[model samples]
Target: MPSTTRRTAVAALALAASSVPMLAGTASASSHPSTVVSAPLAKGLYQSAYSERHHVLWATTAVGRPPVTSSALLKVDPKTLKVQATSTPPVTDAATGAVEAVYGVAVDDEHDTVWTTNTRNNSVAVYSQRTGKHLATLPNVAHAREVVVDERHDLAWASGFGDGTVVAFDTRTFKEKKRVTVPGAAPAGLAVNERTGTAYATDLKGNRLIAVSPYAKDPSFIPAGNGPISVALSPDGRTAYTADQAAGGISVVDLRKKSVTRTIPTGAGTLSVATDRRTGRVLVANRTAANVTIVDPAKATVTETLPTGPNPNHVTVAGTTAYVVDKSGAGPEGRDQVHRIRLGR
Candidate 1:
């Protein structure tokens, strides 16, 4: 009797040990470390941001060239400004179709994964935070332009550049949960105020700003400046900024009025805009002028203009560092440099 009881306990413990992985697999994975691997893009980096958990800068390379291909995503150490890891999304065989151009990436801290959008291929790719493994691809999207992840809402919204629609996917299941139509035309940029269940899309061709209530019906468009290419919101969510490439200016829109309050002119051919919540200043990247215009929202004036590399297309504010991608040429050999601009210096 004693021997049988001991054997039964041993069997039950073995069973529990064998099922441990199966049970824990259902839970979310843990985040990985921050490290640099390659610096292939010294010049042509188009966009970058620092991951709050990983403490690394994630950058997107444009659609061109050998080293700076459309699909390349670089991870850089924030402390050292050195490349940590370089990985590409899964690509289909040429016989079937090529991989889409990855234009944007958003880290989901909840799942310990990175979500990237392939604009031309119309797909969203998920990668592991630790091993950089290709987890899966969410397909059937249309002309995906940019993506914003809302972990609190358990959703990821993508802007369709060709179809003029915005698609929302459930991050937990990676399934399309909603498809909202835009009021105007080509959806070029996207911004989401998840706190209010509101998302905004900028229509470049239509010269309007489309607003969507993620929890409600069809979205509405508010007339903004001409050729609105990029959109960003203040941390307080009281104001929004739109970068107008055609108008060569930044439209300041009051969220309460949902209308353009003012326009701040910058170098011609402005492509991207970002707001620094810490300093309360908005940064606009001007492609044609090769400068970054810093605007003080409270004062409604351009506070500073800093010179950067040739053809600076996108700018991201990471703590005290400003990462600007300068694409000198349209081809693969185009020398693009990611410059680190120390703020308040």
Candidate 2:
């Protein structure tokens, strides 16, 4: 049970979050006709990944702060949005005795594993995709926020938000490969080009993108919009899209030029972005506006905006379907939710 003071604080935060007004320059759901299916999941749903090989969706949930008592790794059927299996993380600390709560998740279909970021514990944990068994936990990652797996290189990369670094791990051995750091950078979202073995991270504090190559001696920086929190690459790996939280838009970057070609305004608090290979559309999750904006990257135009519940935190697209996870609920307890949207041709 939570303490009385903690409950009060949570209630106040929920009220404040609920009161946020919708921002300008975003389309309404009425303008477009699309099929949307949603389901209420566990608490503290933060990030999600879709496994095409397993035909399941992997998500992470962690509730409360230190001594996180409630947390689970969920394996869900993407078609029905039902939880197929749940696995709890192991305890990391003996004295304080805190559970390794997972906040970020990524799927490695090649190795039949799932990788998650233990943000509060400053570590990354790997689990068996088939059995949900706890495989390994690697410590010393500073404020891990996002994890991305490069199947071609057999590497899993995690963003260290606190120390302005990104750490790479060998998927086969579960060993630390290397750590790439940039001064004054606070990486929040990460994406990788599997063919090139190059990773891109959003510098939340510096308002830039850090392009990290495994073989490069020094990482290069590309300017982005204000507060780019999430990033995604196009199917051809020629373009990068970033959700600019502060600017309330998406920054489109050309990988060859290493610069932002345009910034498309979507809505308030654009927190996460994902590209749909089937339709060539870019989906941006607006946390404050309680909606997801779909853009056509070829035309640089907003085609549709789908309404989500409160505080939509992350979005991922698999095939023609898009999955979103949000933080807040109707009551003070803050039950999180997961939404699935089908993209029609």
Candidate 3:
């Protein structure tokens, strides 16, 4: 967590209005999904997720407090781009005495809990999904990047980018249940398959993906591209696509065998990945290219590149809509933007 004074300084950078343009440009128009609308938000963008039960979208950003109070969760309308609610998730880490700077947010609609990765505090904080009230905070996951809630198994899984491990916590009691280690992997993002009782994590440093389960002796690896930062799984949990930032492509993995099936070239600086299973589309956010590449998984080829911003790093698809979060940097850290694109299907 940043100091109070530093938080105030960081808050100044996010005071921009939300009237920025919708979509920059479209390289291709398809019957799949189209750019519906993109709006400008405050800086310090991280991740976006959709709540199916509530039929709304939620996004997280890293910001200091000043003129505005600190509530990292923002409830957004999926269709109108209107900010429905902003929750100030205020909490001081009992051990560190620092407020949570949530960088990753995931919605558990069934449990009505919003799970966030408190990156600065090296922990994950849970909140009431609707009211945004602090429910619980699970500490000890050093450098936690993203968290996925397994409602069926009553578990919450997280990736420790700083410690090279994937930890799991009991959802009912918020207790440490299991930890699967991946030495030197620098695990950043993970996907949990509740039905399969397995989890897949990406190793940013090792350039591979690992599947972990309590029944397995050790984690199994799937070779991915260089600098793999994020990953997404197919609906059936049979395939996974890894966003290779350094390699500038998407690595398709056969999850059943834990092996790379193909390396599909997307574009330079592919930072994040999200899949729309119904349409068979894979979306990758190219940070260096500042665009979103819509790839057809069956063909393993890029179909369209839509302009987002200077750095489009995060993306998630809800129904026919794709929400992309961009983080700008350097001067005042002015890179908070959420671009929502609509799909035609």
lDDT by residue (tens digit), candidate 3, 19-47: 54334445566655354345566567788
Predicted structure 3: lDDT: 0.76
Taking the candidates one at a time, how many backbone clashes does each contain? 11, 0, 10
Model 3 poorest ten-residue lDDT run: 1-10
- Compose the digit string of candidate 2's lDDT tens values, residues 154-206: 99999999999988999999999988888778999999998899999999999
User: How high is the lDDT of residue 139 in model 2?
Assistant: 93
Cα distance off (Å), candidate 2, residue 21:
26
Q: Which stretches of model 3 miss by more than 4 angstroms?
A: 1-21, 29-33, 64-71, 91-98, 329-335
C-alpha lDDT of residue 98 in model 2? 77
lDDT of 1 by residue, 102-197 (tens): 667777778777777776667777777777777778876677777777878988888888778888888888888888765447887778887886
Best by TM-score: 2
The TM-score between candidate 2 and the true structure equals: 0.89
Predicted structure 2: lDDT? 0.84
TM-score winner between candidates 1 and 3: 3
| Alpha-carbon RMSD to native, per candidate | 16.4, 7.2, 7.3
